[model samples]
Each structure stands twice: as structure tokens, then as C-alpha cells.
Target: MRLSDKVVIVTGAGSGMGRAIAELFAKEGAKVVASDISEERINEVSTSIKEAGGEALGILANVAKESDVQQLIDRTVQAYGTVDILVNNAGIMDNFIPVGEVTHEHWERVLGVNLNGPMYASRAVLKIMLEKGKGVIINNASVGGLFGARGGAAYVASKHALIGLTKNTAAVYGSKGIRTNAIAPGGVNTAISGTITAPNQLGMEAIGRAGSAPMGEAQEIAYAALFLASDESSFVNGVVLTADGGWTAH
Candidate 1:
């Protein structure tokens, strides 16, 4: 067990990459906190982990909200003593709307969940992590953070900002035994596409120009995250681990 006796919090644990991370972390001997906005989905993931002889707790949390993020940390400490890892995995996709066509509502909603959520969660957990002088923070960023046409304006911007945040956190806290890093995953089969209700032709055309890459699985990313969250990555910090199967090699 790579994470034996560790306490981990994985937001958006209801499905896709988040669910995979929670389950895998549990199997690695961590007490998993599977958080999601949906109560039923979160409960299912938590129940699944326990049924597999792993320890897990399901908590409903909308990471976009500060109060919810605070409660999440408070509840985790109340249950598991302390948090050893925090996976900022909860995020949403924009509808491929470029800046020209993006409305304020769309921008705020995307930034709120994708950017503000991680910021809030990271801020709350830093206090706990700093006290212990040892902790890991993994941000599930996207290739959009690295390239321009991978997503809409808001989505790409939020992820780019997230990677920046990851580096800044790592630089400031690495000496304190805190490792903050990010994973930039390529296209993966996930429910996040459900958020793309309205696609913009210009944005779609821009993405088309970039060409397609092989799709990855949620578990594959979970493995990358596992490495980052474990002591094996002790010397790795403030880096963006790209798991895009050479999609951006060209």
C-alpha cells in the first residue's frame, strides 16, 4: 500500500477521474474522502470502496462554494485526524465558447468551479498542511492549460491559471515538506462533456485545426495522480506532469 494510513480528500469523486482516484487511493490504504456535488453518486463511490475492503467516507461538497470547502476540510479532520493529500479534481467544461461569444454568466460559472474552487480548497487545506509540515496537493489540470485551442476561452484560461497556482504553491511550500503539482491530461472519456451544452463554431474550428489525439482512461490519470500523492514523488514538485500520450509532441 503506497498510501497506507494516509488521509486523502478527492473532490468530484462521484465519477470519472475523481471516482477512479478515490477508489485507487482507498486500495492503496488511504482513508478516502469521496466528495461530490451529487449525494447519491458520492455515496455510491464511498460504498463501493468500503465493499472492496477499503475505508472511505462520502461527503457532499460543491467546491465552487467557500463554505462547502471549509466544511469539507473540517469534516475530514473530524473523521480522519488530518489530511495528507488533497486532489482538486472537481471541474466543469465550457461549451467551446470563445471570448467573443462568451457571456458573463458562462465565464463566472466556469471560473467559479474550475479556478475558484481549487483556490478555495487549496487555501483551506494549506493551513492544515502547514501545521504538519508534510502534505501533497494534486491539481487535475488539462492539456488546455498547456495549449491554446484545446478548449474554450474560459476553460483554457481557468486551467492555465490552475497550473500557475500549482507552481506558486509548490514554490512557497516545498521547503515546508509540501509538494504541489498538477497533471495535464489529454482528452479522456468523462461526464464533463455533459456540460458542453452549447458549442461555438469558431471555437470548434480552432480545436479542429489542432488535430486529434488518442483518448486516455480515467484510471490512467489516477495512476499518475497516485505517483504524485505518494512518497515516491517526494523530490517532484512544482511541475506539470503531462499524460497526453505525446499528443502535443507535434
Candidate 2:
């Protein structure tokens, strides 16, 4: 058990990549706190974890809200005493549009979820981790963060900022036995569709409808997160691990 006796908090656990990561982490013998905006969705994931003989708690919270982020950390501490891992997985994508045509509402919503939410969650967890003097933080960045115009203005900006946050936090906490890293996932198959309206979000599919790159399952990204969270990555910090199926390479 790579994570035996570990306590992990995973946001956006209601569906998609977050769900897969939470399930995998639990199977590795960690006590997991699975959180999402929808109580039903998060509870479903929690139930599955418990049925598999793993300990888990379900939480419903909007990550963008400070109160919710604080409660999430408080609830986890109450349940497990200490947090060994924090996965900043909660995020939202705006209807992709050129910045020239993007509305302020869309920009705020996108940043609020994808950037501000993670920032708040990180701040809340950092205090706990610093006291413990040991922990890991993984951000769900994107391949879009690496290059130009992979997504609309807001999506790309949010991801870029996430990467920056990962690096900054990692640097700040490295001396305190903390490791912070990010996974820049390419394309993965999940059920969180219908939120994106950008015609050519992936770019590869945009030019001649080339179709999206060879995509991996969300479990693949989970594995990347797992490595960073586990002691195996003790020497690693402030790094962005790319899990995109050759999307960034091309």
C-alpha cells in the first residue's frame, strides 16, 4: 500500500478525473475525503469507496467559496486528524471564446473556479501541512497551459496560473518537508462534457478536424498524482508532470 494510513483530500470528486483519482487513492489504503458541489454525486463516490472496504467521507462545497474550502479542511481534520495529501482537482471551464469576444462574467466564473478556488484551498491546507512538516499538493493543470491557444482565453489563463501556483507553493514549502506538483493532462475520457462550448478547444481537432489526440483514461492522470503524493516523489518538487497523450509533444 503506497499510501497506507495516509489521509487525502480530493476536490471535484463528484465526477470525471476527480472521481477516478479519489477511487484509486482509497484503494491504496488512504482515508479519502471526496468533495464536490453536488452532495449526491460526491456521496455516490464515497459510497463506492466504502463498499470497496476503504474509508471515505463525502463533502458538498463550492471550491470558489472560502467558507466551503475551510469547511472541507476542517471536516477532514475532524475525520482523520491530519491531512497528508491535498489534490486541487475542483475546476470549471467557460464556454470557450476568443478574448476579444469574451464577457467579464465568463472570465470571472472561469478564474473563480479554476484559479481562485485552488488558491483558497491551498491556503487553507498549507497551514496544516506546515505544522505537520510533511505533505503533498497536486494541481490539475492542463496541456493548454504549456502552449498557445489550446483553449479560450480564460481556460488557458487559469491553467497557466495553476502551474504557477504549483511552482510557487512547492518552492515555499519544500524546506518544510512538503512537496507540490502538478499534472498537465492532455485529453481524457470522462462524463463532464456539455460545459464546454468552444468549437476547437483541443486545437489538434481544430485544424482539419484532425480529431483529438490519442487520449488516456482518467486513471492515468490519477497514477501521476499518486506518484507525486507518495513518498516515491520525496525528492521531486515544483514540477509539472504532463499526462497528455502526446498532445504537447506535437
The model with the greatest TM-score is: 1
* Per-residue lDDT over 109-148 for candidate 2, one digit per residue giving the tens place of the 0 to 100 score: 8898889998998898889999988889999988767865
Candidate 2 at residue 204, lDDT? 26
Off by over 4 Å in 1: none
TM-score against native, each model: 0.99, 0.94
Give lDDT tens digits, candidate 1, residues 56-134: 9999999889999999999999998899999999999998899998999989999999999999999999999999989
Off by over 4 Å in 2: 198-211
Clashing pairs in model 2? 186-244
How large is the C-alpha RMSD of every model relative to the true structure? 0.6, 2.1
> What do the candidate models score in CA lDDT, each in turn?
0.95, 0.86
Collision pairs in model 1: none
Model 1, residue 59: distance off in Å is 0.6
